[model samples]
Target: MSAEIMPYVVAGAMAGGFINGLAGFGTALFALGFFLVVLPPFQAVAMLVVLSVITGLQGLWIVRAAIRQNTRRLARFLLPGLAGIPIGVMILSVIDASTLKIVVASMLLLYGGYFTLRARLPRFERATPFWDMLVGFLGGILGGAASLSGALPMMWCTLRPWPKQETRAVLQPFNVAVLAVTTILLALKGAYTRETLIYLAIAIPAALLAAQIGITVFKRLSDTAFRRLLILMTFVSGLVLMLRAVL
Candidate 1:
């Protein structure tokens, strides 16, 4: 790898890592968005996955908390979710760039709109097994397409009856396992090449360092403020993605 490109990779990873650590996901989405401006979509996706694995591993420490809270529930929810990963990766292997970008941008817009207008909606807090499966499938599909596996699920899970700590905890292990499985599948599909690996080597540690800062910042914020910020970021990110795709 040329030293010339190393700084850019590190900078991108650092920004991605901070966002992921603050919000539990978005590193890959952000990184891919940035990289796509400079590289081919496949190469961008490959680079995103590499960094996701690093961020996932770095954030895996949150799993201990989940295990302590509700090992049985986590096992049940995450195991089914894990089973969807390979299928998701298979989907990714065949999807073209325009199709993926359109679909992902549309989803972001819809989810962002929903969150933006959430307060005006009727109260509905029922969680059926079907809902879990649906979310798992959507997470897998989106994860494969755009590495957005947990963003939607995170919001939904947090709104569930589960404790805040437990909800957040479950996400890390589930995400790490998903990334691990998908990474192998992506490699098998020829997504990750030597050049991507070199970029990843530079990006991973930078992401981890920024993630530490994000964690500290996240911990300091109030729940209300966090929720508001999450919605705002989602809205802005959705707009950015939509504009990127349309333009």
Candidate 2:
């Protein structure tokens, strides 16, 4: 990459990494704005998945205990989500991705805005494995169809009263897994040219450091605060998605 573009690469990495560390997701939503400014859509996306997965590993280690405790719960969401990915990819040939993004973004704005303004988040203490599975499956479908894997799952998780670690245990790993698959698919499609690798070298370290800073802030937050943050992020993420699709 030229020196002219290096700033965008570093800026994208830090923005993406900080949010991922803070919330255990959202590397793409935050990073793409900087990236699309200097790089093509395909190359920008290629770098994002790689950054997300690498930075996500740090988040995974932080939530390891919660993950071990709720392995079954995670699997209920993950396995079905994985199964839905290929089908979502198939749907891509037939669907208008931009339109689908708008629909999902509108739902996010409606749900996120309403709940964010309220005094409290909704609760679902019951362990509904079936619903969890359904959300995971659809999250995977969205991931495949429009690169929106986290939208559904984040919305679902914010409803509950789970501790921050438990919530991160679900959201962090789910995003990493989906994005890992995306990275592989992109690799097969030759998205990772030599130039992409050069950009990744500079981006990765910046992303890692930013993620650590985000994790520090995340660690200090109360459970309620974290959930509120996620809700607020949902609203923000939806707005970002809507703008990217429209403009």
The C-alpha RMSD of each candidate to the native structure, in angstroms, is 3.4, 0.6
Q: Give the CA lDDT, 0 to 100, for residue 139 in model 2.
A: 96
Off by over 4 Å in 1: 86-104, 117-127, 145-147, 161-163
What are the per-residue Cα lDDT tens digits for candidate 1 across 65-140?
6667677656655767776666766777787645676666676677767877776422235746676666766676
Q: How many residue pairs in model 1 have overlapping backbones? A: 0
Q: Highest lDDT among the candidates is held by which one?
A: 2
Candidate 2 local Cα displacement, residue 61, angstroms:
0.4
Computed on alpha carbons, the lDDT of every model, listed in order, comes to 0.67, 0.95
